[model samples]
Target: MSKSRIFLFLMLCFIGGVALRSLVFIGSFYLWFLFGVLTIAVFSFSRNRTALLYAALIAVTIAGALWYGRFVPEHLALERFVGQEAAREGSIVKDPEFKNTTQRLVVSFPEAPSERVLVVARRYPEFGYGDIVRVSGTLEKPEPFDGFNYSAYLAKDSVYFTVSFANVALVKEGSGFARGLFALKRKFEENINAALSSPQSAFANGVLLGDTSGISKELNDAFIATGMSHITALSGYNITVMLIFTHLLLAQLLLPRTVVFWASVGIVAAFVVMTGASPSVVRAALMGLALLLARHLGREGSVLHILVFAACAMIVVNPRILAFDVGFQLSFLAVLGLAYIAPWLEAKLKRIPEAFKLKESFVATVSAQAAVLPLLLYQFHQVSLIAPLTNVLVLPLMPFVMLFGFAVGALGFVSYHAALAVAYPLWLALSYQLGVIHYFSQFSYAQIAF
Candidate 1:
């Protein structure tokens, strides 16, 4: 076999071995062992010194990855923070204190009273962006529910404690590195809130900016039922949309290649800030950035390889993330399905009419469904029979809906009348689509529960 083919085969074997090891165990050590063995094998088989050097580099990389994974915060430490007294001097690391009937703040302690520290403060604090306060609340570890581990969720995010409302108070303004990120995040939230008025607009903002606070539970349920819930989060679809928009805009401007590259980077960075820089969003942004770099360098990069690299990087940063985070898994697998299976299906279905090339949409939905089906069944215990049809019907209109919805929302922020004129048509279309989803969901056998 050719060297490239051999290399590809080794890579595939390494990935499969890693995946199998992950399922059989709980952490990255086994995967690291597999990686080391594969690296040695690759080096031993290759005749060229350059190839051997590359293999050795890969081995070192995997070794570092394994060490990093081993160093993340312990699960037991996270579990121990439950019902502990809240530290007074804590700073908000995430978005601002948005008030509902109850307010939630995700904060980190600068100097921990205890080594295990992270808290979700649930109280009304005078805390705005960059606010540092002396909270007086007790820390309670999150309780898991319905087979879902809430503690694990917080742990993945590096949160180990939760404070009840009565326990937290504002001390002073927070300073240092994270303050700027939170400031930008707060502004992005304000922009999204100001720009989006209607429910559809709110949903659009959630998809584009990861501001799902405005989306109603009813609408959220409909999205989940119809298998379109990913539309409401900053996922691979949003990343793809941003990349396409950047490429088209740059292409029209006759910009230099370097300038376009930086522009793409800027857009992704802006998007990361706008989306709260969640794990999934960051992963998508990095993957998109890698693809952009490949384009700029005029080298063809495999999406699958880029995806593997991104996943490995994230896992190395926090191995527990793979076990605890559903969003991470869904986002990664969804993108993988689109990157690999969707293209193959599209190629096979290319003979169909261009208008009917809902083939790509169909492939994407099916691919994502295939990846997440077991999880869905395990979590929700129901499978939609109409998902494929629903996706095809709704997919064609998504780009138009997203574009016009954003435009109308932007206009609405400036002028109510003008915004309403643009919004009315967009809402009409979305409402009709929602109606179809609802109608399909109501069918006798629309879904089957295990």
Candidate 2:
């Protein structure tokens, strides 16, 4: 590896070390710094000592900053109300997410030693983004459940305590960019419903924009049975597929590669933002945009750099995601599979014709599945024995579904009838994909439970 790549590698090591330490304990960040210092000391005799030392020091600083930003708030917040419940007022920091019969919102307290609380509200009477409300509820701290640290999951976003079924009054309505984005997202969901009927509409909402709110339990189970749950869970693969498709189509328009690359980046970023910039979406956007910039600069060898750097950056920004976020884990691993394993498998699939996206889809599916399989088994004990086949059959149709879904929403913004026209083919592809999932799910061995 080049010096830059070496630097990237060691930097990632530091960040990964910090992230792993955070997963197991708190207030041990200095250990990571010491480890980095030791690593640099070991490299002191190398010809590239100075350059590598700077790299190590930079990584140490990032690791320290990320750990501090991640835990200091939680420490202070826990000190404030470690044992008792008290009335507190905070601004609703995030849009209310209504999932599986519960409404979740992050509220930021205004008082000293401010902390963010993940408020689990009653199913009804939804709250909006930026809503300032006085809340009185038992502050329950999150803890690990079933090998997944629910606490770390919330802490990834700087949330320490949770308010359950709290007595919340909307002292003020939400405002600003996030609020508008939330409203727009709700409108898009409404448009999805208007464009397609139930089940299909809900599934499309999930696939195209990561909204599985309206999907029924049975249907969700079917998706998992077919090993297609990644689509519903906002896998970065979905976003990557859309970006590739958009780029491919626009490349034929005779647009300059520069324009096409940046346009694709913009489109991917816009979609990520519209989908609330979930960890997976942001990761995918970063990776996709990095690839675009790579192609633009004629430096394709930097893909590993891009992937590692992106993962480290995300960890620095939110280290909790390193272990706690399943999507984050699967997304990075899947991309790694694509980057390394897929190329090696080309000879194995050389006989399969690459037409109609058959070859590409199969290779990508197998690569990602192989990379993510162990983690899947560890994190979610169930596995779809036929996931490779299911993905091959369904993933190729995703781009069409996504594009048509977007068109339906954009047109629905104007007229329902216009949106309906696009919905015909959109629904057709979605139904076909759903039919594939449904059929595969019928087999007794399609998926196995632990």
TM-score of each: 0.72, 0.86
Query: Which portions of model 2 show Cα errors greater than 4 Å?
Result: 26-74, 78-86, 112-114, 277-280, 342-366
The per-prediction tally of clashing pairs is 13, 0
In candidate 2 the C-alpha lDDT for residue 46 amounts to 58
lDDT of 1 by residue, 128-197 (tens): 5456766666667678887667776776666666766545667777665556655656554454455444
lDDT of each: 0.60, 0.74
